[model samples]
Target: MRVFYAVVLLAAVLVLNFSLMHLAPGDVADTISQSMGGADQEILDKIRADYGLDKPFLVQLGHYIGRVLQFDLGHSFFFNQPVTQLILQRLPATLLLVISAQILALVLGVVLGVYSARKPNSIANYFVTFFSLFGYSAPVFWTGILLLIAFSLKIPWFPVAGMRDVTISGGFWIQFWDVARHLVLPMITLSSIFIALYSRLSRATMMETLGADYIRTAKAKGLSNRQVIYKHALKNSLSPVITQAGIQFSAMMSGAVLVEAVFSWPGLGTLAFQSIIARDTPTILGILFFSALVVIVGNLLTDLALRLVDPRVGGRK
Candidate 1:
């Protein structure tokens, strides 16, 4: 049933994205004409006909849906390449950035939340609260710029832009380290806000979970503080955090656009930005479809994780 719903939802998303994009002002033809120093009506018409943009809206949409069904995302007017190929080239970079940020946020957030919850009146707890408020309030792009200025300019600890050192020539590990260095600022910037959210949420959930009857019973049974909190309370508190993570995947993807733009990372976000500027409908639409697919798949995986964490949620017992 979940798979069935996902398919239906994907189809709806495809149709909606196609409709909205095509309905927007200007298109690839206009962009091309402008780039070519403003062509005559005959030239513009020829360009439209060549790209099949001369077809009626319904006919164009039909062809688009048919091609998509076959995994043909069409060609980019500006890039002069297949949309699928272009997206595939950049998908890895975006996935790396977004997933890395998410993992960082989740790990740090959960740890900080748990620690703070364990000692609500401690200095560490106060620091966590302050940090959460500041991180949550600061914008992602602003964070990236500040990191760039501090680490890349003033401190000179990392490179300012791009995914890897194009100038460097070395072995796999050296190259890996280079890429990892470039990834640091962007990942940190993207994860900062989410960390704030997850920390606060986890703290609240942990506090409540610690007060549960089972938690008290576990302590009464001679369990140590660490055992009671880490083993008994932590798992129950993670449900909401996991659920929120699943729901926030799409927002993280959106945030990646700004972060990628700031750092000049060669990812789907950068590709989407360029495509939008050039009115590359095929490329933009393809990115939207791919993004939607990723979010849906992420949500499905979240469901699976929840089932593993709590079998009762799936009625497995």
Candidate 2:
């Protein structure tokens, strides 16, 4: 039943995306023509016809939907490469950034949250709360620039832009190190907001769980502090954290456009931004669908994880 709903939602998203793109004032051919010094009407019409833009909306949408089902996203107007190829080339870098940011956020946020919950109303809790607010409120691009200036320019600890140094060449380890070096600034920028949100959410969830009857019963049973927190409170606290993290993951994947453009990370967000400026419909649609898939998959995985963590949830539905 869940799988069925997922399919229906994805289909609706695809249709909405196709209709909106088609309804836009100008087609890809018009965009291409204007960029190329204003081609004659005949030439523009030919380009449109070649790209199937001349077809009626339903027919074009039908062809597009059929092709997508077959794993074909069609050609790119600007890059002169398959849309799939362009996406694949950029996907790894984006994934690396997103994954790194997520890991940092989860680990640090969970720890801080747990600590804050344990030490509620103490100075440490207050400090964590204060810092979280700053992290959450700061703008991503501004944060990136500040990090660039302080770390990259002032401290000279990291490079300002690009994924690698021009001097480095060959070997997997060397390439990995280079990518890591460039990733630091962007990852930190991307992670700050998520870390703040996660910390708050975790702290809240943990505090509530700590006050639960099971936790008090465990305490009465003379369980060690660590066991009470870890085995009793923490496990129950995870459902909400997992739910928030799943939703945040999807948002980060789609919402990193500004950070990607600011940092020039060559991720899907950057690609989508460029495609929009160029009015590259295939690339834009590709990104939208890819992002939707990520969100859906992330949510599904979260649900599964939640069920495993607490079988009661699985039995409920």
TM-score, each model?
Answer: 0.98, 0.94
Instruction: Assess the local accuracy of residue 18 in candidate 2 as a C-alpha lDDT between 0 and 100.
Output: 90
Which pairs, if any, clash in model 1?
Answer: none
Best by the TM-score measure: 1
How many steric overlaps are in each model, in order? Answer: 0, 0
Model 1: per-residue Cα lDDT over 1-317, one tens digit each: 99999999999999999999989989888998898889999998999999998999989999999999999999998899999999999999999999999999999999999999989999999999999999999999999999999999999999999999888989999999999999999999999999999999999999999999999899899999889999999999999999999999999999999999999999999999999999999999999999999999999999998988876798665
Report lDDT per candidate.
0.95, 0.88
Please write out the lDDT profile of model 2 over residues 62-115, one tens digit for every residue: 998899888888888877888888888988888788889988998889899999
Give the Å shift of residue 177 in candidate 2. Answer: 2.2
Best lDDT among the predictions, by candidate number: 1
- Shift in Å, residue 193, candidate 1: 0.5
Relative to the true structure, candidate 2 reaches a TM of 0.94
